[model samples]
Target chain A: NETAKAELGRATWKLMHTMTLRYPENPTQDHRDALESYFYLTSRLYPCGECAAEFQQLLKKFPPQTSSRRAASLWLCSVHNEVNARLKKPAFDCANLDATYDCGC
Target chain B: NETAKAELGRATWKLMHTMTLRYPENPTQDHRDALESYFYLTSRLYPCGECAAEFQQLLKKFPPQTSSRRAASLWLCSVHNEVNARLKKPAFDCANLDATYDCGC
Candidate 1:
């Protein structure tokens, strides 16, 4: 169960990070709203109840950074690290995010 | 790039399958709408352009079977197999779906 949970977390994170990385550099307000709504909806519907609750709380505290691709990606990286810290996992260097999450899409 | 794309695909699929498996057994209209909207939004915002196009086409063709958890999960399983066949991958036994995707959440 724990393994499944962790795997799901990793996959969700990968998808989200890649999404931000590929977000339009110069986004319109619609794009920004879409991104924000996507996150909230994701939290609302995430399969894991506990994780969803935690994510909702995180969203309330951190919100989402939707100004630009770099901003969104870095904000997600930092948020992920916060989750990592809560899980007693080592912090990932935010600087390497671009290289790490290049989905080549 | 292909490797990254494939990895992203696997992760996305995992999250999606687990989600369907955990969906409400007797869903209300709101739940059904949310599930359908989630899939549409995911295809729209999927980072990979080609994959997203294919997904959109698939949605149009198959739509979402949102009446119940079993319907949703089986529908997703069949859709995933369709993707696998297109990619020349072996078909998965749909009967084994519950065992394969126990997220323990």
Candidate 2:
């Protein structure tokens, strides 16, 4: 179960990071809504109930920063580092976030 | 670029399918809304613009069926088969939907 959970987490993170990285630099209100809504919906429908609850709590604390691509990606990176800390995993260097996930879009 | 797109595609599908499979058998209105919004948001925010446009078209043709777990899963499977056909890939066996994606949740 732990293995499956970890694998799912990795996949989910990949998708989220890639999507955020690809977000429009100067998005319209609609684009911002879509991005914010996506995160909330993911929290609700995540396959792992425990992870879903944790995400919901995180959302309450951090909310989603969708003003621009830089803000959104950095916000996610910071949140991911929070998760890493809780899991006793090494923190990702947020400075290299842009270099880390290249969707080649 | 193609490699990144393919990798992103696989991760997105894995997350989507597992989320649908784990959807409640008798979901509340909020849950239904969350599921529906997730798909639409995905269409708008997908990392691959071409793929996102294609998904938006498919969504227009066949909107997300979030009434129940069975409906949601079957709808996704059918749509995935549509993509497989487009890519000249073999169709997945939808009959084994539950058996195939064991998230070990």
Candidate 3:
């Protein structure tokens, strides 16, 4: 029984290691969309609040470019959801899910 | 069960402090492509033959990623894997999954 306990302990250890990931359960349809949204946002790396403000302004400034305008929704959400697993914070709140990104980031 | 074995050994020390992640099972991709690879390369800093060869050549030239590469994988397959448990690696390894990293930097 001790031997089996040891073996089960070892396996649990391995799974815990897997959970360190910061995002979501991932590889899901929603997870994929969220990741895709995140990649685009991180790629943008808007350097200032003005850039973010300008992001929303563009639609109003040039309402004709609807595709870019539509993308803003994904951008807002991806920017909000947050994860600080290194912080051992709650794991489910989608870090890149959108406008919820905390200043604690 | 030993108070459920200290809450299953602190939940198996938080699931072996999580398999300590590497180059797989991540968000669809990374930002820098380089980070898409490994910030720590705890995964593929290279197992050796060129860069891995020079790693092989360099390590064979100089040999071993040293206190470094190749065998950390071949080596760590220990208590977590076999024969090295009495070595009580994870009592240390429980806090150490070094060679395996999110590497995505």
Model 1 lDDT tens row, A14-102: 99999999999999998888788788878888999999999999999999999999999999998899899999999999899888888
Among residues 3 or more apart in sequence or in different chains, the pairs in candidate 2 whose N, CA or C atoms overlap within 3 Å are none
Model 1 per-residue lDDT tens digits across residues B1-105:
899999999999999999999999999998888888888878878999999999999999999999999999999999999899999999999999899899999
Off by over 4 Å in 1: none
> Could you estimate the TM-score for every candidate?
0.95, 0.98, 0.17
Question: Which numbered prediction scores highest in lDDT against the true structure?
Answer: 2
Better TM-score candidate (1, 2)? 2
- In candidate 2 the C-alpha lDDT for residue A83 amounts to 90
TM-score of 2: 0.98
How far does residue B3 in candidate 3 sit from its true spot (Å)?
8.3
Please state the CAPRI-style docking class of candidate 2: high
Q: Model 2: per-residue lDDT, tens digit, B15-84?
A: 9999999999999998998899899999989989889999999999999999999999999999999999
Span of 10 residues, lowest total lDDT, candidate 2 chain A = A96-105
For model 3 the TM-score comes to 0.17
True contacts kept of each: 0.71, 0.86, 0.04
* Candidate 3, superposed: residue stretches over 4 Å from native: A1-105, B2-66, B83-105
DockQ of 1: 0.78
Ranking by DockQ: 2, 1, 3
Scoring only chain A, what TM-score does candidate 2 earn?
0.97
